[model samples]
Target: MGTLSPAAPPTTPERTKSRLLEAVKDCDCATAQALADKLGVTVPAIRRHLQDLQDAGQLEVRTEKPGGRGRPQHVYVLTEAGEATFPKAYATLCVDVLDQVERLFGDGAVLRVMDARRLEFQGVLASRLAGHSDLGRKLTALAAVLCEYGYAARAYQENGQWYLTQRNCPAPAVAKAFPQLCQAELTLYRDLLELPVSREARLSCGAAECRYKVG
Candidate 1:
């Protein structure tokens, strides 16, 4: 008699939750109905997974007022904790290149490279933010540029002070390895905003996200 073959592994709620998270990652936010349509699942199933993510502090819900609506729709976005679960290669590649450069020359070579990057970023940001005199608008434009570079940045104000919060870091590993990168980013913000910008929290220093206070 031949031995029986092993059964295939069944998909669990965890896998479903992962898929939901991935879908949310690709978009700014998603609704259960939208996610159901995208994933070919029922609304109830999508809600279940979303609830699980929320319970685990991985997702946030926002209500949107529909234009011709009867009721508001709930939109889900990945929290910083959730965004951290995604894959990031920029940090690893950056560290590898810096290591190679250091081995080829010296520690000073790494500083030069970082300074060069700072100058390039400054030029680009200056160009993008030109002709914007309003502090609020400048910060918004800066946030948009940062988002384009995978920072997931947003700008807001409280107590008459402007702030920028970045939910995701494209180079967490690199920033953790090289503090200069973080300083350079701070400098970039200060220069571009033409305001005194202080880093309130840093992902590299074990914070959930990086936040900057701009005046």
Candidate 2:
């Protein structure tokens, strides 16, 4: 008798797991039930995949008790290791180039380059925020511009002061190496809004998000 062929390898589950990971990536946290609903899979299936991912150190879980709920719900978020698996090229290349620049030119030369970048962004911000006189309006416009550049920025008022919050920093690795970039961002906001700006939190400093307080 002829040799029997092996069955085809299963891939749909793997694809579903990837999709689940991506969905969690887009949110602060996600529950397994929500993930199942979004992915059109059974809760047991979602739990199985989540367990696998957790075992692999790619996911972390937290239990939340919605008040008056029957049971606490499990929420999942990607660990730093998991986030690292996503595509990111800007930071690595930027740091490499900056390292080369420092080796070739000097520390002062790197500072000068950063300063030039700050000045260039100042002009661009001013133009983008033009015609918005009210601080709140200007902040809103500024947030839009930042979001366009991949900052995932939003502006809102709290405690009688306006704030701009960036949920994600597109250049985290670069910022970690060159803190001047963070300073430049604060300076740019101050110059553009024509108001005093203070950095309340910084992503590079391990804050969950980057927050700027504006007045």
Candidate number achieving the greatest lDDT relative to the actual structure: 1
- At residue 67, candidate 2 shows an lDDT of 58
* Cα lDDT tens digits for candidate 2, 1-215: 99999998776877877888898887654898788888788899889999999998999998876554768888899998788778878779999998899899987777778889988988888888788988888889988988899889999998898999998998898999988788778877787777888998999999999999888
| Candidate 2 off by > 4 Å | 1-9, 13-88
What is the alpha-carbon lDDT of model 1 when measured against the actual structure? 0.87
> Candidate 2 overall Cα lDDT vs. reference?
0.86
Question: Which residue runs of candidate 1 sit more than 4 Å off their true CA positions?
Answer: 1-6, 10-90
lDDT of 1 by residue, 1-215 (tens): 99999999987888888888999987554988888888889998888888989999999999976665668889899899998888767667879998899899987887788888888989998899898899888889988998999999999999898899998988788888888788888887787777789999999899988999988
lDDT of each: 0.87, 0.86
Clashing pairs in 2: none
